[model samples]
Target: MGEENNQTVVTEFIILGFPSLKKLYPLLFLLFLLIYVFTITGNIIIFTTVLTNYKLQIPMFYFLNHLSAMEIWYTSVIVPKMLSSFVSENKSISFSSCMVQLYLFSSLGASECYLLTAMAYDRYLAICQPLHYSSKMTNLTSHQLASGSWVGGFLSPVLPVVLISKLLFCGPNQVNYFYCDAQPLLKLACSSTQFTETAITTLATGLIFSSFLLTVLSYIFIISTILGIPSITGRNKAFSTCAAHLIVVMIYYGTITAMYMQPMSRFSLDINKVLSLLYTVVTPMLNPIIYSLRNNEMKHSLTKFFKQIDKRKN
Candidate 1:
């Protein structure tokens, strides 16, 4: 009751999005708008291409399709609001709105972590155990795995967001982030945030490290299997299959771990913002390009997709 009463002191938060870039709002708006359009368009293309193409119906591409879909939602949660902050004079988000945003963004992030781990496992099966891959990663199994990731992702952030909502925000309603991020929001709470901070850190660390460990283990077996193949061309072909996913894993895990594993005070607000952008804005944009450029089948499907559109126009 007291917490609720104290919360009434600050009803909304001012999202101080790059206050240092105040003069360049228009240019930043245009840049982020272009990136946002490209991200949505790119992921949609990947999702549609994987769905329509008969040849790309294997387990690996199946997971990629789910990944593209998730990325679309993940980026959508953050980027659009960020674009609004750039253009609109009113940079405020209501208390309820902020909590909702935090829940969605964190949920999608957790979902991506699980989804990436699942993708790694799929690649491991395909590369390390080709014979059993078909039987083990059946249509039903793939759907379950994909569905499980989404379920896990959404459920992971519920407790954290609930705890945050109960925190007493008595004053200083400014969030020094482009979005309603957990760390920045926690900073504004007037009540004792030690327990909440510890809970977040523990949950985040467990989730991130466990998923990262599984991915690394999968890659280890994958690499060992590839190295044992006698022919150079055969080994190269095997390596090529999982390379894009591995690169993405490294990039995704790298930025997120650096940002979340340590105390926020270790990095300046500007640094934190930049790190957040890498995972939130830049990674989604890079996903389709990485997959399309690295995989021949994806490239072929993309070409066919565009050609079909051209034919329709003619």
Candidate 2:
């Protein structure tokens, strides 16, 4: 059935990115440029802060350093090209380039989910199993956990992305959005996509579900232990550390849950585009602010570091 539909394979695709706002493209470009600047600078600050401060050499901050590093690549996967599209009359992306974007976007997104789970587990150990936390999350173990997230993230999408990219696209050459997402790519394929669709679905489901479940379970244990504290100060202190993590988890997972958890037939392109913006753009920009500003250690470190720079200048 699929072979019959093949006529001519498309070599490149034109992206109709945010076509609804044609008149406002310049303004949107400025907005995106500003966002990219802040996202890059803020995440870099967190990454550098963690590296420079010996006091932050613990597992929690170690994982955070990796998260900031991941955010840099995560948003970079889409934002740079999307930013280019706003100004360039030609928004066409070669088929290979589109697949690369798809792969990186998916890989980094998966890595973040697992990284969040890792952070939640760290909090669980710190709050629920304080004594064992030190021995359990040793420096080597911290490196291993951080490495595992990156490895899992990059590897998870390889097979699916490769398989999907190889699918014949003797169809329309215009993708109605900025990036080449899996579902949109599959829709463009001239071949039967049931198998590819099933594979992508299974991989995505396993990745999102497993990480989300672990994060939820870890938080349950953390909250239970926090409530068990005898004094208000003790409870507040315990909750305070986890509060930032929880806020981040909510923002990250909330958007993803809305985007991915929808039934396949019910996926509205417009809605997905909006939700994608939330996770891919907004969340990356907000991470450093949420994690750094809310935590006492980060505030103190950044304040002192800036003061030192000022003194040196004088």
Candidate 3:
């Protein structure tokens, strides 16, 4: 009975989520709870603002509307479970649930990459190619670009998730990270994971590298245009249009590149934990703040939104 004697396939994984901070569960729970609240509330505000504000019915806000929606989904896929693990005695997730988390998390993340690239391209057209900007970025075209980003992102991680899901996990079902990431899952597989790892690397590189490259190229053209404007006020206005976007792009891509580009060994547990927190939790909250703080139009719309609520309350 060789088949009967083989190790039983693992069906659940104990997420050893930030075990070093075991003594600080309360503090960590409270911290993550606050992060979750802020992230959800902030993104909801941005989404609602774009939808209701008539003045914001433009290409830039169209992309931002999608980004806000993505941030909500992206963070929800990870943080809710992470928060549960912090408070629960049993931090185990079922095999099926873990795979679902993996797919949705990867899908939303990939979608954001393409969505950000689309936003950069929109800014590039509006600033650099101003003559054809209105024609090129029509409502129909914006709708198509947004649709493509979501569809493409949802499809990008399909092969990897399917292949990885088929792997038999024989032993050591304790995941070191808070969530089911590709590297951690690969580390737990009983069979060879070289092909899976290679595939993940290539796909990740294509999404991350290509998106960053396009955004950077767009910025280069953008900066060139801004410099050619001789008027001080015009230059300031042009740069201000992109300042929020550039800040968000830097923070998001910088953390992501550092986390995924390097070897597994490079991801020290503490550093990886911190980076994961930043990417999954902090960035979502920060993006809305950056957009509203740096954008006068967003601020005004937000003001109008709150005033409307106040009027209804009275």
Candidate 4:
């Protein structure tokens, strides 16, 4: 079936990202530019703060450093191209470039999902099993978790791309969004997409939804433990530790769920594009804010660092 379909299908696609809003191009460009700036600045601040503040040398912050790095690359993967699309009338992506974009985007996304899970587990140990928390999330163990998250994230996209490469693209090549996504690519394939679809869906759901479930479960135990704390201060301290993780988890998972957890027939392409923007574009921008605001260590480090810079300038 795939071979038969490939004979008649098209080879490449034109990306129609934000196409109908020619009048709003300038406004959209400014908005996205601001987002890109904030996202990069915020993540960079956290990265530098973590590296400079030796007081923050713990499993939680260790995982956080990796997460910040991922956000930088993740946002970089999509935002520049999106900004270009707003300015360029053509909005075209080559066949090979599209696949590379898809692979890198998927890798970063998967790594983020697992990184969140690792953070949750770190919190769980601290809250629910305080005695063994240090032993369980030792520097060595944390290193392994962080490394695993990155490796797993990169690996998830490999199988899908391999499968996609095998298929023929002989039809309409217009991708409706700013970046190359698996579903959009799958839609443009000239051959039967049963294998590609199943593989992509399985990997996406397994990496995203399963990781989400693990994070949620970790939080459940964490919240329960927090409530059991006898003092208000103790509970507040505990919640504060996990609050940043919770906020980021909600935004990332919520957007992803909205995009992928529905029936295909019921999924609206417009809504899909909008939801994709939330996770791909907006979430990375918000991550640093969420972590910085909720974390006192980060705040203190940032303030001290800025004060040093001010003094030097004087």
User: Could you tell me the lDDT of residue 106 within candidate 3?
Assistant: 90
Tens-place lDDT per residue, model 3, 1-314, is: 47634978999998999888899999999998998999899999999999998899999998999999999999999999999988899899999999999999999988889999999999999999999999999999999999999999999999989989988798899999999988788889988887887888788888899999999999999999999999999999999888999999999999889877776555776687788888889999899999999988999999999999999999
Give the TM-score of each candidate. Answer: 0.97, 0.96, 0.97, 0.94
- The positional error of residue 103 in candidate 2, measured at the CA in angstroms, is 0.7
Cα lDDT tens digits, model 1, 1-314, are: 76566455789999999999899999999998999899999999999999999999887898998889888998999988899998888999999999999999999899999999999999999999999999999999999999999999999999999999998888899999999988898888988888888888889889999999999999999999999999999998998899999989999999999888876456777888999999999999999999999888898889999999999999
Whichever of 1 and 4 has more TM-score, that candidate is: 1
Candidate 2 similarity to native, TM-score: 0.96
Q: Which pairs clash inside model 3?
A: none
lDDT: worst 10-residue window of model 2: 259-268
Ten-residue stretch with the least lDDT total in model 3: 261-270
RMSD of 1: 1.6
Local distance difference test, per candidate? 0.91, 0.88, 0.91, 0.85
Give the Å error, residue 273, model 4.
0.9
Going through the candidates in the order shown, the clash numbers are 0, 0, 0, 7
Q: What is the alpha-carbon lDDT for the whole of candidate 2?
A: 0.88
